[model samples]
Target: MIRFCSRTKLVANLIPPSISISLEQRHQSIATIAKMSDSKILIYLMRRDLRVADNPVLHSLIHNKDHGFTHLLPLYVFAAQQIEVSGFIPEDGGKSPYPEARSQIGSFWRCGPHRAKFLAQSVWDLKDGFEKIGSGLSIRVGMVDEVVKGLIESFEEPAGSKVSAVWMTSEEGVEEKREERSTKNICDKAGVDFKLWQDEKYFIDDRDLPFEDPKDLSDIYTTYRKSVEPLREAPRPALPKPEKNSLPPFPTDVPPQHSPFVIPTKYEEIEAALLKLINAQPLAKNPPKCPENALSVHPFTGGESHAQERLEHLITSGSITGYKSSRNGLMGTDFSTKLSAYLALGSITSRQIHASMSVFEDGSASDDRYKDLKGYGKGENEGTYAVRFELLWRDYMRLCTRKFGPQLFRLGGFKAEENAHLKWSRLDSPKDGFSKEQIQEIVERFLNGTTGMGFIDASQREIYHTGYTSNRARQNVASFLSKHLYIDWRVGAEWYECMLVDYDVSSNWGNWQYVAGVGNDPRGNDRIFNPVKQAFDYDPKAEYVLAWVDELRGVDELGQIFQAWTINDEERKEELGIADTDMVKNPLKRIDFKVNRGRGGGVGGGRGGGRGRPPYRPHSGDRWTGRRPSSQDQGRGGWYGGRGDRGYQTRGYQGRGYRGRGDRGREMRTGMMDKERDATADNE
Candidate 1:
């Protein structure tokens, strides 16, 4: 496990004594370097685009030999503000002085432990890739603009080589765009060229899009999907990895101490430096590790090699054929592609995934290497198409971010004018008649997974500990928080930003807005998910819920385990092994579906009378009915109902079914499920 230290210790350990001098002192030190190169250097600013293979910016730099650049300086800056203390810091035993990011609404570390560690791993892998091709990566910790300016100044005539240009992959986020503008301004002042290369992270490039202007793209996903589906087979191919001779020699004239920054080359040194930066933050009490008992189905290691290996395994193992059916699965690694993290970090590109799928579908992969594989030439199938469909969705989200701009992070989202009437609780201030204390209580319970809802609690716990959860779980939890708990949607979105290992700015914020009824949802505010029905539909056997929420494991009866609040005090203490002092006695009091049957009420309500539909009413056969299974209902999927005698019908179950048993109940339980449920049940 990773260990954390005080902020003072963090700062002390961050900078090497040799390079810890002031700007003026650093310039003097650089001037002492005996050797100088006349060759112009081009600084390639590495950001989210972490890989060397298929990287458009790197490809352009290497291929365009006559571009007037003889040497490449691949630089990656760990923005200090992102890693510094922010929000509430338990390690400090008080609030942090640093404010939240301009794009953020909450007070949480912008880069949590998992994200920091993953990023470090990616940087290390990228450095290794460069070294293999007779190159090196220069790393620093500072503001991007400041760092770039310093490097440009350090390379001035008398000191070393002149920096011809600074190139970086274009990003869609408001903050990233702001950083680009700032850097460009600096470059302009220095008379150095600044270029924003079109990012090749998507399946289709912007030039190939049917829309002449990206803003012309539709707000609806289906409309965008139809517009781009024709180009599905035409996604840009992955550029071949650059060879040592094909690329310009990496600049190594200036000694490490004399350079503007201290560049650590070894993986151990890189990771150690990164950990000190991350652990120095007040929120980082301990290095993040997926608990030993965590139900995580796969151990995620960051790198281009790992991403490629996983993609190949998914195809060769015959798993791609069943992806469409198993994508919604809540547990295990093979349920989905599990490549989002890699894609988000740009360790792997969407074009590469598409290209691999195409090879398998066209039966062109039946070569000697694939002869022993199980699903080498399975040909086109629903599963392969489904993967492509989801990839398009990812592209759509990014496009939406570009189109919406800062509005994507706003409370009203893209259609703010239309959503003016919608009110939500705020963490910083009271809203929707909810006091700050009241709002904090709700948000804290949701974050800690003590909401008394089984499915939501289980999902929250999974993300809180493991920094990951299924897409299905994400939707359900987002709805439960924004639609049901009435908390501000940004809180949930920002929290996910801090917690998710596969955090993509566009997808995370766009999906949150969609679920919060503030963005481009054709259903408007009417799209609500009844957690009980969702659990029944996705995790019928309660295997997923039981896997994370240990307290419910003691309840032998499957039905009562899901609806433990309905289990009486006597049964709860004796049979269920729950204590009387537990908060699971009754569900958290929030949106009561029993009374609120109007707009945004009940299970899945609507925005207005015309479109406002009643909440989803499961068919009688599908309903739990809060009664034990009878001979007729037995074996017909009617076994998981609440006790009818308690008068806790389906309405109550639907309203609060996502809550866990209790925090105490979760902590006291220490047993794992004795047996695994049929994997097929995950598809239910």
Candidate 2:
């Protein structure tokens, strides 16, 4: 990785811009001169770093005068290995035969509909950004190495100048590294330069770390944060967006027939092509739509423009000031900064967000108009600090991926030798205690949200429908699968890779290992989260559960809703209107185990529960039941009445426990209008 200071000096020495002419004017002159000669094309192979702003490669190319490249070709390739189906599936029995990317372990679509749509939207937005600055993005679908090789060959004609070089941002994934090596070999065979710019996705550059090597970095998050927090350059300032016409002109001299692949430039044509690719996957819907109920929780569009808007709103509205307290919130748009999806796809850089927060903290921002906000002028408070802390955690995961290499994706993870004693059920190994069919059933039940644990089920349903879930919910669900169910952690990780629109390979797999007692958790096996306790703690009124789980929506009491199995068949029929036969048909496959006596409890009751450890159970008495509001207080419009449930009224749905919507409820409904307006807008 290149240091920022060194990169700056290199650019200055190479370009040495004149005071008379602006960088854009110089680029225009160079572009005009190039049109008179044979075109020397430089290919920018864009991957995760999708945005044109704060892009090191683009910045370097635009500033440098004597780089020898006359035209810049921005190319994005949808890798075949990531998009094509791995194995065969029957076309008959109402099944589609089109290719889809399936996971090796769970057979889940590697790039599911939600992520596909998000990626497509991001690519289109990037194209727009480029066009606005006098360039265009060329997109193709194929093996990356083959695609690059084809482009090099196409430009080798007598009419075209020699292909100068191929540049791309470096990534740390095992597969990504492999692709890089293969592309380098292709470039070498053709005597072309292959350059990899250091990845600028993280808040802190790797070279600024206190440790010499990433492997020497601390495994614990707290230790790592403490070491780096004191550094003045922990989060460097963001690079400016390239000026208009600063980029070399797009290669317009080459005819369409000269290219190996068809390039669709129109928005409609691009959207249609992306839709075809996405729907080719099994179980994919016609352009995946977010569930009506999930609109409030995940009202997001994938782009740099939307990302900036969200960051601005969070800062200006003083929502980020209360982020530490409200971040664990199960529902609502402003509960947390929904920038993960944008960050994952590189719609916006982490440095941009960090810089914005810094500006807000210093009270220097023009839009920092809210004076009543806590920590408005404070250098670092709990809220702003917590956001930075999370960003550091993201950096740590990526660094761990680099340090651990292939072990990051292995079954036993980095500490494979120490985790040898642990036994997990694998689909391929019947000796591991579960048959292939049994393991399939377990995975399917969990994925489909029919496991009967209301907290886990609700969270599962949310991710399935909207491609999103809060961090609090994600931890609980991951723990439920890995620590509670004793399934292979890789299976859950791969499933998450398929479902989450914000999926990052390092974070997703690294977190799974941490939760499964095989990675960088100092607590190890003690990191288990009891679903029942988590439900009452994070979602006290059962509002989140009632929103997603349809079967539990009929139950009014918080305890009955969270623990539906506890309600008898007679009560189910009398109150919930659920028949015993219907219950039998869709049986509650609840896992039962002994409750903990105290801190150091009983043993040997369930799978993986060793000595001094009992299976998970809810606490006794009122703690589990929760506080229920009385019917007389309905007119007061508290938790159980009025606007609480009326938020869902716009969608023609209402919880059984809440009162009917009224005129007053409609006026109070504006509070919930944060998401309503954005939800109706077409983000894609």
lDDT of 2: 0.65
Question: Which regions of candidate 1 are displaced past 4 Å?
Answer: 1-37, 85-103, 157-159, 254-266, 272-292, 372-375, 417-422, 569-571, 574-577, 580-583, 589-684
CA shift at 236, candidate 1, in angstroms?
1.7
Off by over 4 Å in 2: 1-37, 84-99, 231-233, 254-263, 277-296, 366-374, 417-422, 430-433, 569-684
Each prediction's Cα lDDT score?
Answer: 0.65, 0.65
The TM-scores of all predictions, comma-separated, are 0.77, 0.77
- Write candidate 1's Cα lDDT for 331-375 as tens digits: 998988888888888899889988988887767874766666556
lDDT of model 1, residue 526 = 58
Candidate 1: which pairs clash? 452-659, 452-660, 453-658, 453-659, 453-660, 454-658, 454-659
